[model samples]
Target: MKKNQSIYLFVVLLSGIVFTACNKLIGIGAPKNQLVTESVFKDTISIEAAVLGMYSKLANYNPGTDVGTATSLFNGLSADEGYYFPGTFYDDFKNNALTPTLYYIDGYWSNLYNVVYTANSIMEGAGAAALPEGYKNRVMAEAKFVRAVCYFYLVNEYGEVPLVLTTSVSESNVQPRDNVGKVYDQIEKDLTEAQAMLPSDLRYYGGNRTRATTWAAGALLARVYLFRGKWSQAGAAASTVIGNPGLFSMQPDAAKVFLANSQEGIMQFVNAIPSSWMATNLGASAAAVTPNFVLSDSLYAAFETGDARKANWVGIKVYGGKNYPYPAKYRYINGVGAVEHAQLLRMAEQYLIRAEARTQLGQFTDAAADLDVVRKRAGLGNTTANDKPTLIAAIEHECRTEFFCEWGHRWLDLKRWPGIANPAVTRADEVLGKEKGTLWQSTDMLYPVPQPARNVNVNLTQNAGYTN
Candidate 1:
């Protein structure tokens, strides 16, 4: 479907960098499906086509195509795969370096910026042209939201990037990275604008989670604040959305949030296979993923009996005398062509954040209520926070279980907080030995901008830790 009017039109117009410049945009002359820039404002259909193309970009930005899906891949890492997913043969990611072949990183970075360009074309064209007022505003709002999201992804991945705001691509297009601080500033600018311009409802977002709206913007702002350590702002942003009546509530059954036509999903980039970007050699591809990746024995054993979430994983049918279990998150796709919609967010995370914010505010009892709401859904009994440490532990435990398979939220949670490291290392010593995955130092953050891109973009510099 069209992302918006102008973007879909531009997508129909521009496929890659050849037309990044605003001049080249209208310069190429309009395609048969489009109205030329000089006259598109009079044609709503052409405008509609351009906007739809922006949404299609998300569905089309594939890691397999050497476009970035790093966000997709990173968000998919589980507590178990943090140990296995990064290496040649299942090694801890921190102790080793990631290779340039990590196409997801490259692709995601490229795709996000491409989104920036597509979005800019829509924004600039509409602003400079004479599209219908209603159609122009709607399409521009969608474009801004997507552009805001692109910046968020970039800032999260590479602390800084060239902040290009025009559809005009030129030899001058080569831009150096902005400091992380400046990037965050640009992100806030876009999100604030996006929040104002986007509609209040979910339908306007259009694509899975690809679209951003008022609440999504709020939620993302909360996340940004949290990451930047703006606790009060984070609390305020999260609370606004968390307390928005009739807006969001936990899934009636979190277990069924993934059914083919599931309603609970905020967004996912899933599509029917053989459609495009299928990992080749299907069965063997499936097997390769399983052998190297499975629930860590520690996490597997962590599941309490009667926990319905445990059922999501595919337990080994039989292996010699032992039985093994692998997460079946993607398993039920069943058919080779079945499109398993990827889940990005649901009601579950908001509860965890409210619980966390409450805990951080020292409202232990309230925090406990927040935690219990989620804990109750996962088949875990309600938790009581008898003391400070107890409340924190309870919150951590709730998150581990709540976000188990969707993404490696657990690993990132550990990475965020400080002074909690060594003790956690001691805790994981049994499964991971002396070197637990620790965010012991600041330098450890923001993965090295992979070498391949570094070597080529002379204006680009690597993050502090990596070398070409």
Candidate 2:
């Protein structure tokens, strides 16, 4: 495993910072002209420079953005789509510590904040510069987009976190913890604002994949609202994208879906192409720990023999005499070498969110329609059971079976939705699967904030059940 040996990585959990306790507490709600003099950059052209800063943050933290390693822990932990990563270990993660390694909770923590800080700086700096009228607003919108994404990731990983909107270098950065609800609320607002500002005209011609777009902002808002149980908002946001949704769809073949050169991908980590990657499960050239990324038997059986998704998604191989169904769809980033880019938000998740949201809002028919769209793409015929309970079952089933082994959505999804109320688990009988080794998935949804971070940052507090 390539360690985050980069000097820039200083905190954890938030992705960019790696230091323990007494973290760099710069503060939030920064005014525009503090670090930046309003007169230096006085034109619209320079504003693009600031926006470039926003772009820089993503390029800085993403592994594909790295020089060598292309392992995808951030994507893996996102759930459902990925399997275990080797070589990397956090004490809290391994032992399921209520209070785990804050730094190692995930690099996304530091990586995200690093990006957020850069965004905040650019937004504030460019605004103060007053380069052009709409330029600052659009740039700030991009900052908000970055902020929303950071907070969204935080919410999914840990229930609640501090809402540090300003760069830590600012005096106001010392804001208290916002409840998970409020954090999400802010995320919604940020994305809403960003969606209005982002342009729909941009597209990547080369290997660039991380730039923000209206679809990304809109899709993220939908995901956040669905996560928070705001069904109507979720539906509205989802409709915006689904209304003119991208040409994304399942590869009639599941195996082709994970291939490096897949066409159906909506948003993926763009790597220098023609070459792909596969990080070692045990940090070896061969995936020792990942072990062919076997599909859960239950998930495999859910597909029919004729399902295009099944034939394309899973490969039945005997690794040392044990028959394992490996997810062949991720050949771009999962075998033999480093696939620099990791696909983050894909359109299929949107359909699940829409289907799940519709069910929560009691729009079963609409929900079933959304569910069927995904199912048909996966080559699964519509279910015979037309009832709400049965339809929900099928939807959740599709989510699990169709989306297995991309990253680690399965584990996190269980955390986010442990109870029946979660749209994914509408049926009384349906139970989403669990991790093979840990109850870490059950009692605690997130690994506790690392002990080191709390020791130094006096303002920072520990989670409810952790040992600080």
Candidate 3:
């Protein structure tokens, strides 16, 4: 009964529990025979496995079912980015008529919390383990980064969510929703600590870009600050990553940006299989076949004439004599030797974040310079925007074209940006109202908290416009 051998045994048992629990919501009671975290974190190998498990769970994409695809798919449909053709379960999202009882809504909430709970377990276990200090800190930092990302999405999609920081089910089950500002504060705190604790070298994970680094933390932090309207802080955070030319640079070729381990990637998830889930779902291998998702006419028209991204990143399928454009970012629909990986964070986003932050701070010239870097890569000339208002509009347009159907960037942006007539109204209200024609409501900006989640925990409240 050696210590390392016992810990190894615990890791094996824990794997089963984690895999099983990942499929359901956290509000359900903990399964019987779960091993204690303290026992599992006794050794270095087990601790590494625990951290690796977090990525594994998040990266496990099951076509259209899991959280990995939910953001891009559901959010794309909800916003002006794309349309869902199947008219099945996802129609609710496409029409901005999401209900609390939808299975995908429940699945998304539960899956994200599953990752958060795993991160909490790792941080709690690694803190008290008799491991080396540096190694322990790195592991905990990684967990914090993962947790911060999960919470970021949760807050954006659900408005206010229970800030679950502990692995204890009893504590999580009865927890009430925290305010959006408070949840964002926690995200900022986690990412700030992660930036300090993570390694500066991107090659820490053997040059794979699959693991989190200081640059990844900074990239995400910059985005957080931009969303919060902390313009100066956002610019500074984005500059940290953008300034490091050796570690990161924009891929000159727009087509290669989503390739596995590209120079542009700050953080990506290595697909368990050789192909990407996005490719299988969005990309139709043959022109004769129709894509499940197609770009909206507005998004297709947003591209400037002769923009390379429109040519390279968008695929046109000619079916029934009508052209349908779908996302061609991943390109490989089937597993054919690992050509693409799921990208989480990349250098292009940092540039856009800085561009927006600088525009907000009235540094219009510098902001245009940042915006042009992306535009130039897309084979378009520098932006014609010269003032604050124009620069803001230009930056938003660039983000929409560059990140459409990737990670719900367009959906979230529409919600955050202010409407033209009234600062109190969001762009989502103005834009979606015209597009949806009476289906769009301001309260629909945040999705309903899944009814299943509220059923399990009476403390949970539904978002406005959706009945409990």
Candidate 4:
């Protein structure tokens, strides 16, 4: 019943009947007890609650769960974004000591799969459910959006993974890992279908930004295509999101982006619960009690003297006789006044994606304009990157500084950037430095498939360079 653990801990499953009694815990709609799969989706409200429940699961990042601190904290530690105090339980990540049997590895893997299960459960009931045409399409689209996002993270983190798109236990159990390309293909198909069904006007349930919309679909597609090196598709998808100026626009103040219901949020998870893991780990609220992480020396030094991001977003505190910089993006830990919503997607990233995509397409002049939108927002001048190569490098640098500890954007970018054909594209290795005869290994690029998963499912294979 703890807030930090996955909602799966409270999920009750009986004879293909699934429901959660911990609905009060995460403040999402609860399923009727022992409700059959077909009956559960009969009502429009129930279907909407199911999608909201996925967001509740995604927000549980206090101590465990990969979607929360696992990505925001550990990813920052593993990448060049920040530093974690060595010798804690997190040392394995900061020290680059990842292995199949690592303590929290399976927690992340299970967390994501549990979400996929919920999405699949919703999708399976779509046809049988009694609902209006528009309502049914919206429900199915939102389910696919959540499912596709989870699968995207799964493929990027674990490389290849089982693609379970159904609720049939017999089918899901014996499946082997699919190739990354196949996984990406499924993600594209799901997102594309979802985009068509999503509400273009953002008529989200309860007038909350937490629910997925057409803009969310577009932003996710842009990110997916940009990572896959599909330039035209990436640019067009980003433009689709950016083109909707009424629903989306950059917050003129960089500090306002993380605020709940800020203008910059394209898709966000409402923290109905009082506690915020992002605030607890990064901001000034929990520093005096349990300050576990701080920004790395290199990251703090990456910002220019006049950069407003460094002045406003990055913060410093003296802990244990050493000066440590902590992330002040959230600035609020407890849910008292002005609750913090977990920012899943925002306007800033779409701009960066477009900039990178445009640079890749040899539109250097246009790329510089997009890059400046972010730079000027940070109280800086236009980029010096005039040519394609320099423009691409500038865009990459903007992504690193603009999005440091939000999601695993930096980590994902590091893995994807190496494959860019542009010689000027800054390689991840050139940026990720080594320490004491140890550098990030080729295998380190992808996480090991959790050992516990392989233990039960013999078909599941670990990624290269990790033992089963």
lDDT of 1: 0.55
RMSD of each: 6.0, 7.0, 3.1, 5.4
Backbone clash tally (model 2): 56
Candidate 3 residue spans exceeding 4 A from truth:
1-14, 19-26, 61-63, 273-275
What is candidate 3's lDDT per residue for 147-221, written digit by digit as tens?
Answer: 999999999999999998877776687789999999999999999999999999965587788889988999999
**Per-model C-alpha lDDT, please?**
0.55, 0.55, 0.84, 0.73
Any runs in candidate 1 off by more than 4 Å, and if so which?
1-42, 63-69, 72-95, 99-104, 171-173, 202-210, 244-247, 260-263, 268-292, 313-322, 332-340, 386-388, 405-408, 421-444
Q: Residue by residue across 447-466, what tens digits does model 4's lDDT show?
A: 88877767667788878877
lDDT of 2 by residue, 1-468 (tens): 123332122222212221121124332223333334353245654445445434544543444422112223333333333334332342233334534555454344445555566666666666677455665676677778877866676666666677777654443244445688888778888988888987663443243445566777888888788777788988887787766544445445444543433544544545533124332221222334234234455566777767877776565655566766655544443435335344556667787888888887788888888887777776777756466677656766777776554444554555555355555542211242343344333435454654544444456666666656
Q: If ranked by TM-score, best first, what sequence of candidates would result?
A: 3, 4, 1, 2
Question: How close is every model to the real structure, measured as TM-score?
Answer: 0.76, 0.75, 0.94, 0.89
Q: What is the C-alpha local distance difference test score of candidate 4?
A: 0.73
Best by TM-score: 3
Error of 1 at 5 (Å): 16
Supply candidate 2's per-residue lDDT for 179: 83
